[model samples]
Target chain A: MFFIKKNWLTGYITIVVKGAHPELFFQILAKHQIMSWNIIKHDKETACGRIKLADVMKVRQIRRKTRYKLSFGSRKGLPFTMKQLNQKRPLIIGFLVVIIFIFMLSNLIWRVDITGLDAEIEEKVSQQLEEYGVKTGNFQWNVTSPGNIQKQLLADIPELLWVGVKRTGSAYHLEGVEKTIVEKEEPTPPGHLVATKEGVVANLFISKGQPMVQTNDVVYPGDILVSGFLHSSDEEDTNSGTIVGAEGEVFAEVWYKSEVTVPMEQELQLMKGINEKKHYLQFKDIVLPIWNFKQPSFSEYQIESEEKDFYFLKWKLPVTYTKKTIYQTEITKQQMEAEQARKIALAQARRELSRTTPPKTKIIDEKVLHESAENGKVKLTLYYSVLENIATKQPISQGD
Target chain B: MKKNKLKESIMRSITQIFDLPSEVTLKLPRITTIGTIHAYIENHQGLIIFSSEELLLKVHQGHVRIKGKGFVLKMMIAQDILLEGEISGIYYEK
Candidate 1:
């Protein structure tokens, strides 16, 4: 065991000694504290033995005193093997380069797949990913985490209800569900149609209800215009009547009054469509501008900035990319006559009324009740009469 | 010669009485054989002759000769020699 350890560390060599009684040379070497092993006498004059490489100098000195001729044979062990490897430098370097290249390739995004979505939405999602620096061939460290990506996808694409982002090795997988607008059909119970506003009934289209009020009859809020009960109250057997859900439309005259004020002199800021874009890389609290070093020359401008985080694997790094767009704007002031201001105020009031009303409402008449101009402003009071549906479902209770 | 003989006898008596090893007290060669395949010799002076079928070593007062086939010296140190072969016989000579 000691010989094997020494042979591997310092190395060993086989030597052939040629002379009369060559074995005597090895005995002399042993006496000098230089151990030899595996001695074989090939012939009377030739013998071979293995000796440690460290004892070579001692053997040479002993050779001067003896007539035996010595020649070194095969060499073995770690030192020689290392020397041979050092001579082949290119092979070792090439092996290291291949290992590094493989490691880098493993950390890159090779493929991106989006599933459970339409082709249009899929393309939109991929484009959004590219904008976020998550495209194919991009380094995985430069892209944010899957959770952040999922959130960004949901926020940017309105058509997506829920989206899942998964990273598997060198690939990115996305599964999404599209938002489908579905109209709900509510189950209407046996009930009466009541008036939700104070108005006069202009028209009635009772599909499945008993009409309680006729046309041009005035009704108040909470008043039942249609009854779910088939029998009248004067009937002797009111409890025997069958109750049904009231489905109908009762058009009535609805009125609205509004007061609006408009400034005679108006100031507005308008965009000139000229803009500059700047990009920055932020590391913790330190921000470094990467592009668009020059500031915008416009005195009045608006800035819109967006920041994106960077990640390595599942960890969020303290680095972000910011993009800012500066838009040039101009302020303009205009003076208006009282008549023009009054017209604007009236139109504004009408718009407000229509916005607050339900769909399918018809504006039958509009009038400006009062108009005046003071302190560089025009104030107007307007009234509108609209024909709209006034029927509301009121479920019937057994106790009632 | 007579005095040397007397000293040798005293050393032998001391070894016997003290239960000491003869190889150390008397400067004698101790040869251990494992079946017929290997022979380990300790306290040997030097190698006298070696061949494919025989090995001879100088011991304390004489020479030790071993007759064998395919004889090879497995290892050789200052005071020990390990010889491996098919051993046939061993002989002592003055």
Candidate 2:
């Protein structure tokens, strides 16, 4: 289709052949290989048809022998249009210059877009690229090879698993997939297992090394529960033992003692009611707040505040809405029994024990003892027997 | 004329027995029309007459006259002519 249209644009002329036998003329034209189409006969002696501009000259030379009066009907095609355009030379030159300018401009990287990265990571990568002379408005020819840039990015940005750089027209697209890093555990050296607190050894499960203390043996902090060395049996080779890292769990009856005193009469504060005040600030995520007044107006009130930041279209806005609820309170005095004071002291000691115990420790037995109750106050002591891991890895001292 | 008819009948029989196209076996003109809008004439001799309303083309044995409204000779080469228009009637003159 383009070929035909191009030929039409190259110019074709319609010509009328007035002769006795127009069919003979058509036959002759076809024989000469002169492309002519859309032939319409007016009568027996006259017909009109279109011939390409190249063939018009050939037709002029061939018409002398046919005795046919050739008259051009209409001239059309790019040749005539170009002939008219020849009068305006500067306009054509300007058009050509504009086309060349656009072609050249498209070859330069005018924009750089880095996607699929966290804000911190994107900033670091952008700074790295900028340092490497890769930025917007850099010529595509002057840019380093994408493979080299990707390698540099992968090495410099440890969190990036894969990096890709693609140039599309005037834009450079940088994308990466984040790496999931798994931390390697450091090797634990040969060590002894020591007690971290005072306890009676209830049971011992040792996987390595020799047990220095038996079940029901009372031990204190710094006592070696298990030895890291094995005694050498050979008489001549006499080393103390083969040292290894001690590994095991030691369940023990651990005693926790605390002295807590509670007065019989005390003053307690209670919340009577609550009032809330809310404020909202709307801004872009890049903006920061310089001042925030959060002081409560009431003297004997507690203020609890919550902040909620709004996100629009997945973009975090600096806009934060804060809600503060002021809880009003009143103070009153009351009297308590000695038994009640003892119980409160016991609960306080138990809470402190639990807070100090390791997360995996299990309490098997507990006892509360009222040491004294006098002078409108009471004192109590508490004990807890727990099962826990006491295998403290202590690297063997090289000097020994 | 009688001998020519006998030869034509022999060729027609050969075409039927061999299951070959009649255009290849009998040197006949192939005329294809798409409804009343377009037509293609293959193995045509030359143009006899042409106009917007009527077209006459020489074929193997005679001439084909097509009367139509807005007749256009869309394409013309050595032995093929593509015509497009609202065709009213077609006639063959021997």
Candidate 3:
């Protein structure tokens, strides 16, 4: 028989009885307070929980001891790990968190950078960076990778000399130099100047290194006019730069002035009172202007203002205004007065002299070489030359 | 406000490193007569809930020992809590 709960007033009992009297045991269970009844196969000897009800139910040939086992649902007991998770469920939730800690610490710039710069150049690299995209807190808004953004910015712009972009935690860093070309160079340490031709030295002006020839000295080709060889006092034992700086041979043209003449008709632009404003539009090599007539109303010229714009680092366009006084030339039958001819000749000589002269030098003298009449006008030919010392000489250190 | 969030995240990492038991968080209203701190805490995918007056939790030798007063545990009850109070320690048995 099966037992349920702990109350006797409720619950049905399944009774099993032996001794060939199953109906008799059922009758006795019904006489007492019983809820329900169900009888199954049984051979009872020992007393069990349902053995008290077996006296009423009777069956034939009942024997050995049999007992009832009570159970509910299925099995119990689970894995200890599973049980712990069920208890502390919050811990499992915490385990699955994906952290972008790297983004969190991206406030500071990584590498401070400059590119295309020179050490002693007039323009500073650091100044360029401030003007460009390199600055603090500027990295926060970058949608792309910081390094990639820096590279693209530099590649797209030509003003930058070089670029180096990097980052550290909260900081994005930039490092680079501004671009500059080298022009001036170091001294030609110690060297000798050699002769370029086979001739007597008429004049020697030393610009750099040592002059190996003197005035009136006969020199041959491949001979030393100036020394390219140099040395330091401490390097007396040998001519190597290990004890000093480098010195090498270099040769340049040296010359004295000879008479040269060019015939020219002076056209002096004389200005009258009339004046007009002229405007010009020029993009590149092409010139477009409002003025067309080659003959001007006046010739006194003055520049007003000029403006320029550079686009894409390629095209540079300029706009300029020029004001000029206009005048007319009258060619008439007039004899050349001595004073006027002499003045005109002197001015012509001055122009001829200046053409071959250096910018900072002055004409020393002028003399008439020849004179002739051309097209009813007196033309004077003159011999003129300028005197100036343009020789470059860099002496060895006197070491005072 | 951003600085406050950063500080809060830093505190979270610190707590995880040291394995803190439960965080007692509170927001103060303009005026208060009832208890200021909300005792309810969520756990395990919000499948379980916990509310207690005084919670004592310590991790020793990898075993989590949870002790508290006026504890009310709910949903996915894994461990049986021994309670000694007039209040309920577990709200749902199933």
Candidate 4:
């Protein structure tokens, strides 16, 4: 405690005393109760030592009594530094002002983030918030209450099912849920069941219409399979049939033909582990690259980068360090066997047939009708026979 | 001189009977060393001689002579002196 007080408050000074009998000078200093330390004799005539800055006046009084020559060297300690700073008052004031300005600015919002919405809906929401005077770069104190904003948002957008507004520090968060719409069914006019494609009838079931075609009958597209009109039992009466909508199920055999060709020779691309690296410093949006003199010579390569951001506590600094790596790739051609090509074509043909075929179809038969090879390519033509419902409703016209 | 010797013997016997430290009871100099690199002497009278190769300190009864190379008087107060150097030997001369 005493050492700290001596070092920072009263401070200290080194003094060089040049005179005959310098030892006597130290004796006089000790006699006067002035503390001195680090006393060293330079030669027969000169000596140096340290004394407290407060004892400089005592040294002057002793100089008159003993007539010794004394000169001070350097001044030390925290007090002396503070005195030096006192001389440059304007610089200190400017530094303090800058610190206060930074503190004040940090208490205001600088960026606004909105997520969990589509681009068009996000734009609309942003525009709506702008009308409410809530936007980026705006002070948090000027914004309306979060509850009021949430209520207003729910009222303005009819499609929204719920809304939430939360404020954390200087950032305001607004989120909403959109309502799901349900579709209604429209009344269908009276119609008849017609054949949508040419097929051989395999099964028929009439529910609300008269059957026109029976099983094992071959019909073309646009042919009526079920008549919507019901005939009365009384044959002598005129206008005996009543028109209505047709409803029935007619199963038929439909054929699918698909042709696919696969090349015997193909190219393969492979990536080697050979890569080049570059490092850069990201200050905000600006990138300053280092140690990167030339671009990589690889014609085909993939670029991958990793970035790490600097942060202090909960605040993320705008500075980031990024490392980019470029991996080399090579492409080579190879020959495929005939059997391999045939297997690939068959798989692709089956995938296409399944994609085009309607749901709930029962496959009756499937075969590769023809196969041909020319110009390093193999082609296969496939046929698929299936039984599926082919009945479709056609509305009756006024003239009919 | 005979009377002073008798007084010293009396003081020594009294200190031994009371188990008092000699540095306080007899005004003896206290010397501490740290692996030959540093030496601190308390209750020292004055600097007898100082040099890069050797240093001598005046104590209560005799003088302590420190023989070493690169000797420096690191700190000095009224009765305390701190010396730093490669100490080779230390002895008292009456």
DockQ of predictions, in order shown:
0.60, 0.22, 0.01, 0.15
Give candidate 1's error at residue A283 in angstroms. 31
Expressed as tens digits, the lDDT of each residue in A36-118 for candidate 1 is 98899999999999998888999999999999999999998889989999999799999989867876676688899899999
lDDT for B73 in candidate 4 is 63
Candidate 2 wrongly placed segments (more than 4 Å): A1-12, A19-24, A31-33, A41-46, A73-93, A99-400
Q: How do all models score by TM-score?
A: 0.52, 0.39, 0.25, 0.49
Model 4 TM-score relative to the real fold: 0.49
State the lDDT of candidate 1 residue by residue for B2-94, as single tens digits: 999999999999999999999999999999999999999999999989998999999988999999899999899999999999999999999
Return whichever of 1 and 3 wins on DockQ: 1
lDDT of residue A301 for candidate 4 = 88
- When candidate 2 is compared with the true two-chain complex, its DockQ is 0.22
> Any runs in candidate 3 off by more than 4 Å, and if so which?
A1-185, A189-208, A216-224, A230-269, A276-339, A357-366, A374-400, B1-94
**Per-residue C-alpha lDDT of model 4 across residues A1-400, encoded as one tens digit per residue:** 3663665577888888888866557656765777776666677677787888888998889888876799999888777888899999999999999876665565465555566666776677778887776787765445556787778878887767787888665577767666767675554567889998889999998887788898889989999999887776466542467777888789999888889999999898889989999888989889998767568889988888877544333365687678789899888787989899999998898777667766767888889899998999999998988898899999888585
Candidate 3, A73-170: lDDT as tens digits: 21112333455678888866665432223333333344454334455331444444445655654543333455565676566555556667664444
Q: List native contact recovery per candidate, as a fraction of 1.
A: 0.87, 0.40, 0.00, 0.25
Ranking by TM-score: 1, 4, 2, 3
lDDT by residue (A1-400, candidate 2, tens digit) is: 4546877688988889998866457667876777677776677788887888888888898998878999998888899878778988899999999866765565556788899988888898999888666787765545566777889989898988898988565667899777766686655578889998888888889988779999889888898998777665454542556778787878777766667888888899988776546454536444333344556666687777555443333333466555556787777777888878877887776677678877778778777754777887777666667776655767787675
DockQ of model 1, rounded to 2 decimals = 0.60
Which scores greater on TM-score, model 1 or model 4?
1
> Candidate 1 or 4, higher lDDT?
1
Q: Which ten contiguous residues of candidate 2 chain A have the minimum total lDDT?
A: A308-317
- Candidate 1 stretches with Cα past 4 Å from truth are A119-124, A127-133, A140-169, A182-400, B16-22, B30-39, B65-69, B84-94
Which order, best to worst by lDDT?
Answer: 1, 4, 2, 3
